[model samples]
Target chain A: MKRSNRLIVLTQFFLENPHTHTQLPYFVDLCGTTKSSISEDLDIIHDVFEQQGLGMLHRTTGAGGGVRYIPKNADAYDESFILELCEKLKDPERILPGGYLYMSDLLGDPKTVREIGRIFASRFSEIELDAIVTVATKGIPLAYAVASFLQVPVVIARRDPKVTEGSSVSINYVSGSSRRIQTMVLPKRSLKEGSNVCIIDDFMKAGGTITGITNLLAEFDAEVKAIGVFAEADDEDEERKVTNYTSLIKISEVDTKGNQMEIVPGNFK
Target chain B: MKRSNRLIVLTQFFLENPHTHTQLPYFVDLCGTTKSSISEDLDIIHDVFEQQGLGMLHRTTGAGGGVRYIPKNADAYDESFILELCEKLKDPERILPGGYLYMSDLLGDPKTVREIGRIFASRFSEIELDAIVTVATKGIPLAYAVASFLQVPVVIARRDPKVTEGSSVSINYVSGSSRRIQTMVLPKRSLKEGSNVCIIDDFMKAGGTITGITNLLAEFDAEVKAIGVFAEADDEDEERKVTNYTSLIKISEVDTKGNQMEIVPGNFK
Candidate 1:
């Protein structure tokens, strides 16, 4: 393959796999290149990546050590990408029989999840994101991915404390979906005062969880950097409450009779 | 930084932040290079990564278009890196108050979790991992990360089938720690017949959950590629049952009275 094509393929590999380690000898065999050539190529690629302000390539020395690409700016995404994602969110087929949206597939797709995480990471890169907050159980994966990119910890707000979690600080907030008061809590030491937090979740119906997370952050005297969601139901009025937030896909309106759908960018506005 | 260093750093950035859309203009700005130079460097780095069998880089054109790195050979890692990880897992401080190992911190650590996933992925890369198997709550994240790397689905075996899951296939397995018979289950269609499986969990005390997952996979006539755990409590005979398992840390013994401990590789043998 030409050097240019090879570079593109390689970049895709690293992007797809995060925090992976491999040896140079293995690559030398795979690429049909000499060790010296592989070393020189690595030098060139390393410089280009750094110049791009993407992050740093971490190299481990010795026989077992190799290179790992780490992103410096986690949340960078084009506006059009967000718009396209929003359009998909509006698809009527995604609407379930009972008004619930089918989102398990999107959450399960690694590529989509990665993009969703990057968009948020880019937006919040400048802020000191101490913790990525979410409620169980759908929000856990997104929260974990975003927090991983940011290299920060994620605090899961449970509906009820598990015996495993020891003691926790609880709060009561209005549920956006049920439109009733519900309680959520986290361990006292899980988050500190005056910390910067990013609230993320899988779906947004009435923004109750968002509000709950916001209130919880208040308890810690923390600043809310931004709120992000995988999908937002169209019927809800969540956008009015939060000034800064990002959603990969937006649900516009669900056709109850025909099962058709419409969606637009909630973040692009 | 030199062009070489820039390339390494840029590659790292993409790897760390997977599935992101980054513009060339941003890369140019970050590296203080012209668009042409950044493009050329990207070409070189991409080639190196591919030749090394590290990953693949994808480029999209037009407005809001950018490059993304996808991991190809992420399952490949040096044996020594695995050894070092095993060493770290042996830390005495990891012992909890009870006989249990304090692995929640490790499970919650993104870097550690990513590494653990890579370790298992390396062992099972060529085995056609159909679905990652694990038991409830704590094991979910590890299973998720592994499934993410393998680009496969994860079937969580619930301790008890909740009403939401509908029907399930249950199995009775011996608990490794408690030495008591425990039951675990998976949804009927969760695993296909004659599929290849990879088992992952947070902790393997008596190897009960691992065995449970194995038995569940057997119902589908599936073959297990390998078993992986975040930490293994190194009590006597605990390590005997698990075959082809990898653990990041090991707790040989914990003395509650003196708060003393012994740590080593739980499955090194």
Candidate 2:
């Protein structure tokens, strides 16, 4: 293949498998090129990634050394994107019964979810994550997105364990919003013992659901490395059940009768 | 930036925004390179995509012309991958009551989901999809995956409408396995009228859930362009509620009492 063609294929491979290191010999064999040529191509790719502020490309100059891509920090949420998302979340029609805002539209958008996933992955990138954990329904997609970037498996905790999943471990926790006791279940084989897990969810209210996930992870001897959410409801009167967690959007107020809402960027900003 | 660096950045941009065409002049301004250089880079990227069977790049020569990437046919299911996945599904422990097989592990896996999404995107790439439609829970991730590749949004129908979703339309459909009626809901604004949608789900049994989604879409004046699933149960005795659908894997046999299962590649093979 021509040099340009080789570059395109190489770039695609690197982009698809971020954070994975590939030895120089492997690319040299794949492209049927000299060692120096392969090295030069990688240098160009690395320089471009840095110049565009896309991510970082690290190279180890030794027999075991290789190239890997690390996405930028998730804490550095793009200012324009967050502002636009907050504006959209502030729509009056989004206000529902009991202080809640409609966010499924934003969560379901591929472009928005991709950006959110990248942000979360970037924020938790420093942690040693064995899997992305989340509760069933809405949070599954968010967990899957982050796991994709991190190249890890996603493990969902179900409200009701189906027989299809075989044996499982169940836990009971009080719901923060309803204040009702709810049970969450996870398959025994879904997560490996002693694995480092990053918990994610679509919405957080009082943090009861996340607390339940933490309890469930303990049963398998797994540790909760971090917690991330798309949006979290902020209330002055009610204390949050979970303390250490991150959110992209904060719903400061929701007025159903007044048909209005107060939205702002979360701690991620 | 150097020519090589420009090529990398341009390739990354095109890869990120597949199917969206940007004028040549736009690339020239972004890369600070001449129009001919930009054109040359695109040509090289397009050639590599075609050569590698990764996707397609179409360039318009006229005023409205630009470049776009279209994924290839799902029928190109990497032979080894299907075989390996089928083998994993054949595990007797996966068999459950009523001939259901456990698939949460495969569904939760980013690597597996990525391949399945690519196959689904490839098979339906020809269709003009406005968005990917799916029910809440398991199908959300699958829908999101396909939507990512297609650069479209995902619309999820809920089992029970949450107040946060705003006004919604609900419908009743018979559960093929339980032989009981169940209600499914979707928000009014989730999908636009006259949209061509592709429905996706993790599993299918008599195709009840998919039929429900199709029924729900009709209320919005939308059309079901196609349906895709990760796996479908094979039972000659039971007729599927919906027709004209594709599945990646076939559960030919599931003996719950005996703890035995038979699996194989589906229509895509």
Candidate 3:
């Protein structure tokens, strides 16, 4: 393959398997490229990654150590990218029959989710994250993607306990939508005490669920590193409490009455 | 920046924000490049994506369209990659204090989770997944990761009901570990009827929970595309009903007697 082609393939491979331990010999065998070729490709790939300010590719020297891709910056999503994403959030197809945004497709797409993960990973790259926390269901993917980027374990705050979890630490917080007390819980040993945590979720409505997750994290003596959301419902009241946070897309208003919508990038300020 | 560097940065940008609709004017602004330069860079990025077999860089011309990165073969994690990953699964740190393998970290890591998602995505890429299903809470992340890669919405089967979810469809399945009948539920409208579904979870002990998820999927008239697990308990006697599956690691024996263990990749056979 041409050097350019090889560069693209190598970059994709590295991106696909981030933080994975893979020897040069293995790459050589897989790609049918020589060890020297792989080495040279790595150099080019590393240069490309650094030049883009995307992240870094670190190669471990010792036994059982290999190549691991780590993001050099978190919060790397710029204004234009966020704006473009917010525009897509306005798509009518995203609107469910019952006024809910159809986001499962976006959540499932690897490329989309990876990019979303990268945006948050870039933002939180500086902070040492002990865990990625999210409420059960929708928040799970966002939490998983962000945690995957940070290479941290994720703890899901369940709304209710099930036998599968054995035992859990429960917390009660006011639900943002209902303004009533709602409960959430995490597995008893899921998170370590006094750990730094980043809270992430698919959507933030009243910020109640996040507060619930925040309380759950506190119960473990974990510190809040930062908070992020895929989309934040554009409500002035809810936006007040989520002051120090990042949102990929901000839906300012969803006019179900007129079937119209307004969206913008939220609080990257 | 150099032409090569510009292309790399642009590629990273596009990769990070898939399905985003943005014009060349915006790209020019972000990169400080001219419209023509940005256009050229996009071309290079597209070529690189295709040549690498990563996927296609879809561009929509005319009004209200720009670019989208869709994985051509989202399920293309090669067998060699799976084999190599099996080795990493043997890491000592992965072996926990109580003979439990610390898989939450691997499952939580974005890159590892993406790779894990890809492995399953590649396996079930052609299956037309309607939703990725899992029984909360550990399975939520895995289901989300896989569903994200597949670009489908995930319908989480909760071990119990919560008020927020409203009405739900419930099913009873035998818990593999406890060998007890456990009920799992999903919101009534969460999944569409007759949709193809892929079931995923962080770990499987007796395959009972997955079976529960399968039963829940069926309750909505959804079909199972495939079943996947991050880790499967190594014991052989636990008969699993679902045949189409994949697992990154399998814990055959957790030796509490000697604090030793045996870990291997299961049934990618």
* DockQ for all candidate structures vs. native: 0.16, 0.73, 0.23
Q: Worst ten-residue run, lDDT, model 1 chain B?
A: B94-103
Best by the lDDT measure: 2
| Candidate 2 second chain TM | 0.94
- The segments of candidate 3 whose C-alpha lies over 4 angstroms from its true place after superposition are A1-6, A13-102, A160-170, A179-183, A186-189, A219-221, A234-242, A251-262, B1-102, B125-131, B147-155, B159-194, B219-221, B234-239, B252-262
Query: Counting only residues 3 or more apart in sequence or on different chains, how many pairs clash (N, Cα, C under 3 Å) in candidate 1?
Result: 54
Please provide, for model 2 over A192-250, each residue's C-alpha lDDT reduced to its tens digit, 9 standing for 90 to 100.
99999999999997888998999999999999989999888887768998888888888
TM-score of each: 0.67, 0.95, 0.66
> Could you arrange the candidates by TM-score from highest to lowest?
2, 1, 3
Model 2 DockQ class: medium
Tens digit per residue, CA lDDT, model 1, B219-262: 88989987888776666644656666877566555554525556
* TM-score of chain A in every predicted structure: 0.69, 0.94, 0.77
lDDT comparison, 1 vs 2, better candidate: 2
- Candidate 3 true-interface contact recovery: 0.32
Tens-place lDDT digits, model 1, residues A1-269: 44444444456555544445667786676566777776666666666656565555677888688876665542233556667665665565555554554555556555566656766665566676777888876677777787777777777777776544555688998786667889998766567788888898887766778888888778889898878887766664354455456776676554555266666656533
Best-performing candidate as measured by DockQ: 2
Poorest lDDT segment (10 consecutive residues) of candidate 3 chain A: A72-81
Q: Which stretches in model 1 have alpha-carbon errors above 4 Å?
A: A1-97, A160-166, A172-174, A179-183, A236-244, A256-260, B1-96, B155-194, B215-222, B236-244, B256-258
Q: What is the interface RMSD of each candidate, in Å?
A: 6.1, 1.5, 5.6
